[model samples]
Target: MSKITIALEAAVATVIENSPKDVRQTARQRANVDRAFAGILKLIAPRIRHFIRQYGLVAHWDDAEQCCAIAVHRAIEAYDPAKAQFTTFVNWQLRGELQSLRFRLMTDQRPSAKKVEATTVSLHAITVGTEGEEASLESMIEDENALSLTESAASEQMAGDLRAVLIGRYVDHLRDVGMEQLKRAARTKRPAAQDLAKPRFKAPNHGIDPADIADMEAKLAQHVHLVERRIFDDTCLDDLEQEFGIAKERLRQTAKRAAKTIAELAAAEPRFASELNRKLPQRRRPSKAAVQPAVTIVPDQHAAHNLLTNVVAITPEAGEPLAESIDARLAATLTTLVSETLN
Candidate 1:
């Protein structure tokens, strides 16, 4: 190894080295807020044009300029003194933000950098309510998965329907409680053994026997179409009343009571209420076009049965006895064939 001899001199500041007295650097550090946001517009302009041409992400040039300004502001906070220029440091930062914006736009999350101020929603903000002050948005918007009105209403209506069905099921039982109390004369009389033995109605017990409640649920399930039709579609109270042969006022009262009961159930047992939405019946409406094609009773012979059949009138409505007429001689054969096939 060759030995090298070095002579030391007073060091001078190179361009790469930081100068404590540099006026421009000091000004940049102190007065960083520049009113000329359009300063960076030229830098981001070509990129915006390229993005529009290549990706076809529909965003105005002004929007890109604003985003670049925001990124530049953020980058200024992290400006490295070792970097050759502040502008170069900001260029890369602005580029990254624009690229991120492009990716977000591609995914259909169009962020409005200009319109939406850089702020935060305090998810824990306290808001006063009828009951008391409570947690804010985080508490209120609990079900983010339930996004659509139809979906939200379906769940809500199920709970309501279940509550209504429960109320309607216990109508006679509740009425009897009031009636028996009212008819108990001021003067003492012989207490009926059955009345004395009857269970006292305390309500989260639902004022009814558990067996009666189970029976009600079964009945509601069997006639779920009634609830679906009345609550969900073609909600004609008069039609329902006439169809069921119940008094119109009585029907209205029953409906009103059911509504009130559902509200109570929701307040008391919200978790159980939310689960009830799964039980809501969706009404199936068959269009005339859809129905007419599927219903053609083609009287064809079957090899399995070795029977031939002809068709006669089978009326579905009172308008007319609609039927496809086949050979009159085969009418008996067809009737016999149908009976045998069905059996």
Candidate 2:
């Protein structure tokens, strides 16, 4: 049959023939079975590495490698090729082992006070980037001020109502057709005399006749297309296809059209640059607004008060040694509790 089937059959034959004489085999068959096991392990090692990376288990690669090896051995011993492919059976066993290891590692450690402090410091350092390349606190503040100014200028230029419609229709929910329909409905409801009496305005809306609402509609269509590309990358295509009942090819074509329109609008309009500059404020570096204060609350407040009072009242003679011991123990317990909470 297939190469896999042939290999598996050979492996099984070897295993059966290699069985010990007392247990049910010959030295020759045993050697063949051992050779098969080695061959299978070599073939699967790359697959194990690929799986580890694919699942973001790279940090635990060493343990995952060992687990995969063990899983393969177990699979070989228990495999029933009549019911399932050997590769499929082995994959199931490997997944189960890896998941078990993940659970064990997650649950085994009791978090300690030192661990919490270390994590907090690490997160703070990460926000500032690497040591040499980090922006100075002063520079960060200045950049923030510039961003805010740009945003205010842009906001002043764009009609508040139109900006809200653009953000709500395109940026937030990606309802391009719905946005167009809404605009059309609003135009229909506008007083008929107002619609008819324009100065018949024309260019330096740049080749786009300022008199034409068609040009603005065209620009809005382009903006929505650019946003969809950013939100849905290749990994999301399958889900999008399933949810929308559209073939992958059709969805891709639609996305491309939208992106092209957005690129055109960005290229054609001076206001686009100003708007982009304003939006830069939305991309500002995350601030410490959400940083939480570190605090420990003890349920046994009365006990804690008594202990503190006794330590404070200690006299030099008999109390000093006992108080030192109690202080050390209290410090250790507090450290452990803090660590667990932080973790």
Candidate 3:
């Protein structure tokens, strides 16, 4: 749009083409030709900048500029005045070169679309499972070494006793987790209809009878209360030291046994473990009730610390009598009651 560009274009159309006989020979004709070339450069200069930016050629601008210059020159040389306007012809030519330029600058540009190969793995080729009955990798399988069935029980003697400390800590952990989950559930707003349209997850079967849990809880609670009070009393610890040569470690193991029993009890009856989630009262439309999820304890830092502390406290001194007394039997009997279900 510059005056020089406009003038050069007009000059090329009129003066340069019409005065071809005098071109290169006459100084005036040569001036017109030079003007036309300058005009061409001006026309493609902005386009070259655009291509550089569009093709991410800014890092190699000088090279891109040179390429664009060559493309422009080729366009001018190959131009057919009878077929199209100079501007249209130049645009078409530049477009082709720009397409190729874009490919070259792509870093991984290919001549055509990349062909993707279909991938399939032969699971049947691999055999797995126990010796004789081994099946292919495709068939459902499991490792026997990984076959660990967790049962809640202890040695016959200690099975009668349960540790109150472990049960109390487990209860505390459960309460904490329940509070957190309830708070989160309260804060959560229902999703939109579209979101609800998506498939909802179905919880796996717990296989627990809540009624059994209630019965076990009642029996266990009575024992747990009595045992916990005795455990904290120094008289009880001294009695064990004076009568039974029971190791403090044996006490912790006893607690662990009780903890395992509680776990088994809960597993046996999920309903008693946690009440079904009850929604907060609403004045208007009632809200859908959520299922109350049970809390599971995995031994971690806090649990480990609790165990260590209990061990230090319950452990009797080496100087104390290792001999079992009648008083120690009461302690063992009370602890054993934790596992026994009330008739």
Candidate 4:
């Protein structure tokens, strides 16, 4: 076998042999484990540094390196050959640790390119020749600044794209249903029949009495009509009390009693029994339309331009023209994907 492979096998064996069957360790064994850990750290430092640089974690390289070391140590302590290969397991552990560190740094706003550049320039000036150090620091700072700006712009664009995607999806999905409800609610000046239907009515068997079925249907219809009217008319509990000449609590009690009667009636009918199994009441569309036609308030190009300018002024800098353009393109692509998938 190669020297590296042999060394790895030896390390694995050392770890397995040194770990006690019991949780507790003797002083000698503990010392041996510590020595083994130190050896492993030495072997893994270069690997950790390579991973850090690869991930563009130069700003927090020290913390990233320390986290990698901790990850490696954790992997060693928790190592079980039966579960996975040591290297494979350690790599997974290291990657998770690094990702967590990256998320924390990104969200916390402590590690910025400007701060890193300043630190780098100071360190370089102290150790290197003044002119070369100055040039290098300036170059590094400019590059870092550009990268930061690009990343910020990209993030803003992404957020806008996501927002538009959600809004479009939600609005499209609910458009027909919401409009139907609004229209239904508005026109009758009464809530839809379905909303106030008696919950107690059930579909009777073929052999059941026609009178019983008819009575149940009539009650269900009445209940549905009443609830719909109450909602559509915007009748508050106080309004109910005033209209019925009863206390609010008494009105609520009466409604509850009415609901229970409906539920019982519904339970007797097979169709309504199935509906009663549902946890919540059914929603109905409004009779009235929700949206009105757009009005032509501005007749001239100057008026239109002024309106557009006002809108632009109110919009956030993050949501301005350049950012919005990128966001719109991204949203269009995503909308196409959504349409294709639904189709």
Candidate 5:
């Protein structure tokens, strides 16, 4: 134990011992408590600073420091010397408050959270031209028909896999409830000391056992099936209630909670994220002239030159593969047309 721990222990003892009944009688006690708290805060200032730095709560230093003060106050009030040392007790409370502060500051709904939902982008939606072409933020950034057939098939397969993983999570959640029930039942079955003193041949194990494990597994299987039918299969809540003899409202709540959990799981799980967040392919769009009809120049006569016998097509400068060849052909056609007209 360090000097601060010793000081805190003494402070806690002073507060407990000097505690008074009436407000008028508490002046001396209040003075002592305040002195003790002052000493405690001074000693733990370094610790408070460490917590702020360690948890990335330095931006909210004032709030974090206030929380530290509250934790110190709460620790002094609630500390049981027999259970834990003052240092251990206060540090736990400090950590909890700081974690909560970090979570509050970083949650999605706040503009200060720096999350994507906090930012706004206008679509700038417009329609133009004879083809009724649409221009918008989505069109500018995203490619048309981004996913190929193979990728779509893969996403469907991954969806099934994600569903299976979510089912396992739901079953685990149910099993936790079952375990709690078993613990309560075991506690109820536990006999008194006198009952235990009267030794029988076989003493009952009033706790979870192999038999309970098997029974819980059996029930969990039924719950897994119920989750699949109600949530994944989209079976109506009333239908599930009628089939399972459970209340419709109860079934609905259970399914709702499971659905929420599934959504959280999908958001957190990387495989699900990769499958779900399919970014639009940023494919380069072909220029308008590339898709336009080729303009053909038909000459009346090929009298002087056999070179101009073939019909010529003039295509505009579009980002096409055969652009150079088309340009060369157009120049030849234009030269022949001019020469023949002069002739």
Candidate 6:
């Protein structure tokens, strides 16, 4: 009955009547519709604000405003003059939006809810202490040594992966040593039972003696610990070699293997790879300390001919069956080694 209520109804009617159905509207038609919507929003602005306050959504005022606008747009699209007055229809829509907004704000998993809880705490407030000598909440919470849970978990996972790779290498080394001993026994025509009786490490699930496996595992654990310290703590290879009585070259070789294995592992896991890349120190460029002239050697035709003739003269003898058997055995061993490496 009021002029504002009549004007609001007219704007809603204009929207419903002029809104494009199956095709795009003309620019003029679009402008007319937009003007109608602007009028409707202006008329409902006070109502939206009132409902937001009514629902106690002060902390989320901006979000509540957005929700109210969406609710108004939906109400206009669905409104029917025959059913109820535009004022009544819009009031119900605003109420629904306000209720939903409140629910979202109060949900435990919502970031806004977390923020609200965070704001409730005062950093300077004395939460722990005895009377005069009290510590603030912020002081109690801060820790210099504390690492974020994500970074801590990532570091632990990376260390575990490194340990697994080291143990794998040790196992492979033991197998290689056992294989050589087995080969020697076969060449000497030793009995199979005698070969098994000797304390030699063999591939897992193969009929390796239990005592040998236990010993291998113990040695693997000790080697892994020492290698872990060397790789992670930047411990000197010389110190490890002297302390453990192992050759420094062997320790250096182990570190190289670890680097290669870690690269392959990181290639499979992007998250770990990114973390590793971020933590890796930048390599320094070598300084230009010295310059030397290049030297070239002249090739002699006689020497080149001799080298070619030497290469061409060598050939495998087809008559030697022992050589053929050896070749076949070597090929089979190589195939098995390749398959194991891939796995």
Name the best candidate (by TM-score): 6
**Candidate-wise lDDT, in order:** 0.53, 0.63, 0.57, 0.64, 0.78, 0.76
TM-score, per-candidate, Cα-based: 0.22, 0.29, 0.27, 0.30, 0.32, 0.33
So what's the TM-score on candidate 2? 0.29
User: Model 6, range 219-247, lDDT digits (tens) per residue?
Assistant: 76676667677877789987898888889
lDDT of 1 by residue, 228-335 (tens): 456446478789876777677766676666556545655456565666555678798875664443344564445345365554555566323223333554797889
Ordered by TM-score, highest first, the candidates read 6, 5, 4, 2, 3, 1
Candidate 5 wrongly placed segments (more than 4 Å): 21-25, 108-343
- Candidate 1: segments with Cα more than 4 A from true spot: 1-32, 35-70, 74-92, 98-208, 222-224, 230-343
Best by lDDT: 5
Alpha-carbon RMSD, each predicted model:
30.1, 30.5, 40.3, 36.1, 28.5, 29.2
Worst ten-residue run, lDDT, model 6?
Answer: 307-316
Over 5-32, each residue of candidate 3 has an lDDT whose tens digit, in order, gives 4543464474336345543467776676
Specify the poorest-scoring 10-residue window by lDDT in model 2: 118-127
> Model 2, range 1-343, lDDT digits (tens) per residue?
6776567667655664575557635567667878877777776677788777765567888988888878987887787768987777888888888877765554333256346543222222323635667754455445657778988988876656544444453443334454555556555664435456557554333232333446556655564443443343334667766665668787677676655654555545575657665644455686668867556663344564565553234467978889889999999999999999999
Better by lDDT, candidate 5 or 4: 5
Clashing pairs in 2: 19-25, 111-340, 112-339, 113-339, 222-261, 222-262, 225-258
Clashes of each: 0, 7, 9, 29, 0, 0
Superposed by TM-score, candidate 1 places the C-alpha of residue 299 at a distance from the truth, in angstroms, of 88
- Model 1 worst lDDT run, 10 consecutive residues: 3-12
Q: How many clashes would you count in candidate 4?
A: 29
